[model samples]
Target: MNLLKTSVFNCLFVCSLIFFLFFLLLFPKESFNAALNGLVLWFRMIIPALLPFAIISGIFIRFHIADYFSFLFKPIIGTIFDLSNEGSFCVLAGFLFGYPMGAKIANDLVVDRQLSKNEGEYLFLFCNQASPVFILNCVAINCFKNENLFLPIFIILLSTSITIGIVLRKFFYKSLKWDSKEKVLKSLNDNTSPFEILDSCVMNGVDTILKLGAYIILFSIIVKMVEIILKDFYYLKTLIIGFLEMTNGISYISSLNTSFQIHFLFVLFCVSFGGISCIFQTASMVKNSHFSMIKYLIVKIMTAFISILYGILYLKFIY
Candidate 1:
């Protein structure tokens, strides 16, 4: 079964890449515009938001700064999540920095042995989430055209990631736990000077961000091709767009003549799922680590569905 599934996935992936190449050749204008949009977004929104956090998170991990979390904050957040100081730091990075950053930080922690292998894999699953700025500003105001919609969207997205993480932790990863006292920070990176470490982090962060930009551009082009090919099946086109890359999907969703409920649910699903582009970016980040991309993808699909369920309840009761 596993071999069959892997073969199927490989076949689809190869076909998709070939089709994308066809898109590049056939519709150069559309593809150029799509690439431009993705590049502009990466330069304007993603870089400013992520680069600083990326460098900071890397420095924090390298310096074992999480070990010095304040007495007030540490006891509450650390104990609550059953995380060591480092894991608690990752939660903050996840919430604040968003998506693959949390995953990157979690992978770093496991490499540094700040978290056990089970804990690290478990941490990235849920800690990886959409940015608050993207949720509140991009999706809520820009796409939905209503700032008031932020609360419901925020609640649903946050709740879904947390709930999914908690359920998986309870069932499959029974052995993962953090004992702060037991953790001893040891690092092979200790030989580096502060300057070297800072330089390395900045370089790595920029490289990661560039890869993210590439995925975004690649998927943006693919989504544009979807637009032309599936114009008759509007709903299907939208789903395919949302599945490929998130930002373009949200922009496309906004321009549609759908009902408010449709807008809300599609945005909810796109943000919740993090899109295929997001999944690929995340997988690249942890490719060297023990983290499971398959598990992450499965959980993301689950999150998308759960977000819609939450959206339904919210729309029925609260909206």
Candidate 2:
């Protein structure tokens, strides 16, 4: 059965690639423009916003900064999420820096034997999220043109993430044991020189960012191709693009002459789900680890749904 499934998957993947190539050939101009747009976005927005966070995270890990913060974070994270001290760093990175950072940190912890596979998997679900900066600055103020929406959107996203974490901890991670304290402590005590650590961190950060950029470009092209194919159905096109790549999806939605409520809901959903592009990027980050991308995808979908529900409730009650 497993072999048959694998064969079927391979066939489907080959067919999809062939279809994509044919589409590219059919619409060369569209493909070129889309690829160019992706490049612009990578160099303009993603690089500036993401690179510093990646480098800082690398430095933090290399220098065992998490160990210092772990003492303060352990009590709260442990009580709420049933996670160890190291898990607090993943939470902090995810909340502060956003998408794939949390996953990257969890992967690093797992690789260093600071966190067990089960704990890492649990962290992967809720720790990886849209950054507050992206939500407030990019989406709320810039895209929506309403500073008032910033607090609401930020609160909703943060609350939903914490709620998901709590629920998952209570149900899924109850059976998983924490890593050995001695091993974690040993890994935290690195004797490498500061210059050497800095060099390694910079190199690793560059490699990770490059990989992220490639995924963004690939998905941007795919999303554009999909939009070209579904030209007539504007709503469907908006959703399809959003599902494939978030920034483009939000851009399309914002351009439309739609109701504020509709626009708000759509943006909320897209940001929460983070689109397929983000999923692929995160999967690449955790490929070497035992974290399950499939499970993470499910969590994203659930979070999106919850966000939609919260928006609706807020509208009915407050707005």
Give all candidates' CA lDDT scores.
Answer: 0.83, 0.84
Off by over 4 Å in 1: 1-12, 70-72, 178-184, 187-190
RMSD for all candidates, in order, please: 2.5, 2.0
TM-score of 2: 0.93
Weakest lDDT window of 10 consecutive positions for candidate 2: 180-189
Q: Tens-digit lDDT track for model 2 on 144-210?
A: 9888888899888888889889888888778556645635533433676778878888888888889
The residue-level lDDT of candidate 1 at 6 comes to 100
Off by over 4 Å in 2: 175-192
User: Which pairs of residues clash in candidate 2, taking residues 3 or more apart in a chain or in different chains?
Assistant: none
